[model samples]
Target: MIQSFRNEKYDHKVEILTPISGQDHTYALLATYEGLAEMELQNKKMFEDEEYKELITEFFLQNIVQGSMTTQLFRTMTGLKKETNSQK
Candidate 1:
């Protein structure tokens, strides 16, 4: 669940497919760090001060959504095939 611009700019909610393995703390932390780095790279124009940028990264790093893409894709593909065969 993401709330942007005080719930006014983007109030829409999206359904996400989440996998099980990334729920572990190690992967979650690594993913969050990677995401923060990417954000810093992209939002370099918006934030000029290093300290403020570090604060933003700290907040995001504290909260990260963890998931495994491989597991979710495998489940979706296998489920689709199973359903198709059952229909036939």
Candidate 2:
């Protein structure tokens, strides 16, 4: 599934993370975009792709637990200044 998403050639970053302490059986798939607009554009393209559709129907639907999936979006806080070591 991770490879499939990478093959789509979208202009974003993707990563899969496994828990170190909590949630032993759970994994997180993270996709980062420049902003909301780029996220929307890439999502539209992803859903429209035939390969992605096939993956969802043939693989994701069968293996993943029903009602166990969730989607969340987060954005970095704006106007935050990076504190240099010297400033501390």
Candidate 3:
């Protein structure tokens, strides 16, 4: 984990997060990747292609729990904490 501070109304300093320290993250990645693969293979032109699905999986695997509202969909999936003003 890493701790950093932001110049908020107060010192927003804290231990940020402890990453997945074992194979669970890997399994979760594989599971989600497979789901994307299934969608790409079966679903039509409304969405994903092989390359696009690969890109999505890559992003998901790289940051399962990012601290940003723009990544809302991912936060919901990974159960990431709610974003605060300081986090933004």
Candidate number of the best lDDT: 2
- The lDDT-based order of candidates, best leading, equals 2, 1, 3
Off by over 4 Å in 1: 1-45, 66-88
Per residue, candidate 3 scores C-alpha lDDT tens digits across 10-84 of 122222333477644332211121344543444353133565456556766777666432311121256579999
Residues 2-81 of candidate 2 have per-residue lDDT tens digits of: 55475457888888789999888788888889999999998898789897778767867676888888999999898989
Q: Could you tell me every candidate's TM-score relative to the true structure?
A: 0.23, 0.77, 0.23
TM-score-best of 2 and 3: 2
Better of 1 and 3 by lDDT: 1
Q: In candidate 3, residue 51 scores what lDDT?
A: 53
Pairs of residues at least 3 apart in sequence or in different chains that clash in candidate 3: none
Clash list (residue pairs), candidate 2:
none
lDDT to native, each model: 0.38, 0.81, 0.38
Residue-pair clashes per candidate: 0, 0, 0
